[model samples]
Target: MISIPKDDPAAPDAFPAAPGAPSALETPASPSEVPKETSASLQMPEGLEFYAPNYICLTVFAVIFFPPLGLAAVYFSSKTTEANQNQDWEQAYINSGWTGWLDVFAILIGLAIIYVYTLYM
Candidate 1:
């Protein structure tokens, strides 16, 4: 638990930096002078690895099952590939997850159709 002295109420400068340490107010005045990393410039750090999933399973499902959902899955899978190539790990992961869901849905729908057709016929 944090206990504040009665004499020192919470204020902007209530907490002081340790001696010789730079304060937030001491930051550079110009944004250009400050070094920053942007998303576009991001790269997969060395020693860490990410493997993009191939579209083989999704493609097979698309070929044998629902074409529409399969197509959308393939589309997102393509986007995942693009992101992987660009080293955009976040986007690649998102697109890959989306593709995975679409593939799952397509498989479920296909199985349902097969079951229904066999039962009705």
Candidate 2:
């Protein structure tokens, strides 16, 4: 992409640089283009190699609403979070998959328990 300074005379609009503000096109960020707090490098946990956790609140709710549906999701979230904190993105991604299967397993087990309880009662 052809990047042109916003204040460049050749720019279609040719606007002047804002007094203390850096025009993105005109001045490349000297050191930190993006702020450290929001940067991806800072967010990742240690030991993380590839994956990242997402939609954790939804994952937690899935567990709460269907507790019988595997608390694997709970474990997954914790592990994922830990991995992220430790900067192990890839491992966190892998752990996320386990949560879904565990939930399904929990559901099946829960059903069996209910059936046996009903039969005995």
Best by lDDT: 1
Error of 2 at 36 (Å): 3.4
Residues 7-99, model 2: lDDT tens digits: 777777655765765667766556676433433546545434555645466555556545744466777768877776666657867776666
Q: Rate the local accuracy (lDDT) of all candidates.
A: 0.76, 0.63
**Any runs in candidate 2 off by more than 4 Å, and if so which?**
1-35, 39-69, 81-89
How well does each candidate superpose onto the true structure, as a TM-score?
Answer: 0.58, 0.41
Instruction: Give me candidate 2's TM-score against the actual structure.
Output: 0.41
Tell me how far the alpha carbon of residue 113 in candidate 1 is from the true structure, in angstroms, after superposition: 0.4
Top candidate (TM-score): 1
